[model samples]
Target chain A: MNSVAFVIIAIFTLAAALAAATLPNLMHAALCLVLALLGLASFFFLLGAEFVGLVLVFIYVGAVAVLIVFTILLTGRDSREHRGFNWSGVVIALAVFGCLTWAILKAQSLTIVPPHIRALTVRQIGQVLMAGYVWPLQCVGVLLTAALIGALVLVLEEKR
Target chain B: MTPTLQAFLIVSAGLFSIGLLAALSRRHAIFILIGIEMMLAAANLNFIAFWHFAPPPHPSTGVMIAIFSIAISAAEAAVGLAMVIAVYRHYRTTNVDQFNQLKG
Candidate 1:
């Protein structure tokens, strides 16, 4: 049952990601990206990373996808040039895929026998985030604040 | 067969490759940003999968890092799209080919 769910989620994720990448319409691609992000969240959940999964949905699908859509609409240019297929990109992507697949296959023999899975509670994660990881967490806070202000400054219309 | 770590890696790799292609091929700046987001997501997926499978004694490390990446990517998207909006306002086009202003 778990494997079945995993397979289903993986298929959805990969297909949506492919669509998000290949679709010419920026709007459609953004929609596909939402689907892909949702599928990835489910994949994380299946892997038992519950917090990360929820964050993926909330952050990626909720915020990032919305931002992309707004940008597409604001820019008023959603269509790609009608230059047919971009063969160079296809070739490069295929080559990269081939190399990565070969690497994965070769590296399979060097796997460390995984220790029994350890279940981590959100409480532990929170504790560590506040205690051991406080500095980086603060840095992220500052980064987000700066990003918010910068975005506002960039998009604000200038007074004549 | 059950999904293994290798399976996850393969999926992540595929996602990353697709993202690379999109980033390289797409003319729209927003689409390029989307592709970059995909690549970031792929890397996060790899991190979470490894953490889950062979986590160190401190299991939260992986999740924390993934959380950080998610935060950073969110910031990235916000700022990136804002730049896109500004660029569109000035240039009236989002096509990468048209932004060859610095090309000597």
Candidate 2:
């Protein structure tokens, strides 16, 4: 059952990612991004990262993808022009893929006996985050604040 | 056959490659941002796959890292789109080839 689900979700994710990468329409690409992100969230769940998966759904699909769409709408430009095929880009992508595949295949496998993990819950995650990971959490909070301020400063129209 | 960690890693590699293609080939700033997002998602997927397969002592570490990565990308996407808006307003175009001021 889980394997079937994984196959379905993986296919959805890859297809959506392909569309997001290749679609000529920016709006269509943004919509595809949402689908890809949602599919990723499902992958997280399949891997037993439940809390993180839910957060991915909320923050990525709900917030970031929506933000991309809003930016497109607010810019009010026709961003549909295809830049044609980039031969150099295709070559680079293939090169990178080859390198990565070779490296992944050459590397020694580290498949340890799966350690016994106590069932993880949202409460456990929150506790651990606030306890052990508080410093990094605070730093991310600062980064988020900075981003919000920077965005506002950039987009806010000056009254002439 | 049940999906193995190698299967997940292969998918991630494919996604990353596709994303690189998007980021490199797309002339539009927004598409580049989308590509970057895809790459980031691929990285997160890799992290989760390793965490699940290895089952670390601190089991949540992978998830924790994934969370932080996602948070950072969210911030990145906001700032990046804001920059794209500013660039569009200034140059009246988003095509990478047309922008000539940066070539020194």
Candidate 3:
């Protein structure tokens, strides 16, 4: 049952990702990206990282997807079709996948089944974030602030 | 049989490859950014899978890193889109091939 669910979700996610990658319509591509992110969140749920999955949905589907759509609207649509597809990228991507799959198959340790464990709780995550990871947390906070300001500054209109 | 760690790793590899394809082939700047985001998400999946499969007394380390990565990627997407918009304003088009001013 678990493997079955995994296969289904994997297929769905890959399909959505392919659409997002190859769609000619920008709006459709962005929406497909949202679908792909949601599929990823489901994979997180399947892995028992419920908090992480929820956060993924909240941040990715809520904030990031909305931002992408808004940016698409703001940027104004381009009626012209993009140039022909670049086949070299397809070759490179396939080669990378083959290499990664070969490496994964060669790793003897990776075939082990997952051990039963307690599901991670939000409280545990919060406690760790405040205690052991406080410094990194603080750093991320600063980085987010800098990013927010930098994005605004980058888009701000210059005075004549 | 339940999926093994290798299965998860392979899935992520496929995802990462798709992302690479998007980043490499797409002419639009937004598509490239989307591709990068997908790649980051694939890495996050790998981290979570490893954390999940590790033996007892599992550390919250992988979960923590995934959370942080999500935050950072959000910041990255914001900044990247802003740059995209700025570039569009200047160049008046989002086709990446046309931005060859720096080619020497």
TM of each candidate vs. truth:
0.93, 0.92, 0.97
Candidate whose TM-score is highest: 3
Which lDDT tens digits does candidate 3 get at residues B1-104? 88989988999999999999999998888889999999999999999999999989899999999999999999999999998998888788888999877422
Kindly report, for each predicted structure in the order presented, the TM-score of its chain A compared with the true chain A. Answer: 0.88, 0.89, 0.96
Per-model C-alpha lDDT, please?
Answer: 0.84, 0.84, 0.92
**Residue B57 in model 2: lDDT:** 64
Candidate 3 residues lying further than 4 Å off, grouped into runs, are: A79-81, B102-104
Give the candidate number with the greatest lDDT. Answer: 3
A1-160, model 2: which lDDT tens digit per residue?
2579988998999999889988888899899989988888888887778888898899988898888888788665666855586779889988998898878766678434445445678888899899999999999999999999999898776466
List residue ranges in candidate 1 displaced over 4 A.
Answer: A77-85, A108-115, B55-58, B102-104
Q: Comparing 2 and 3 by lDDT, which wins?
A: 3
For model 2, the stretches where C-alpha displacement exceeds 4 angstroms are A110-117, A158-160, B55-58, B102-104
Sort the predicted structures by DockQ, highest score first. 3, 1, 2
In the predicted model 3, the residue pairs found to clash are none
**Model 1 DockQ class:** medium
Q: Looking at model 3 chain B, report the run of 10 residues with the lowest lDDT sum.
A: B95-104
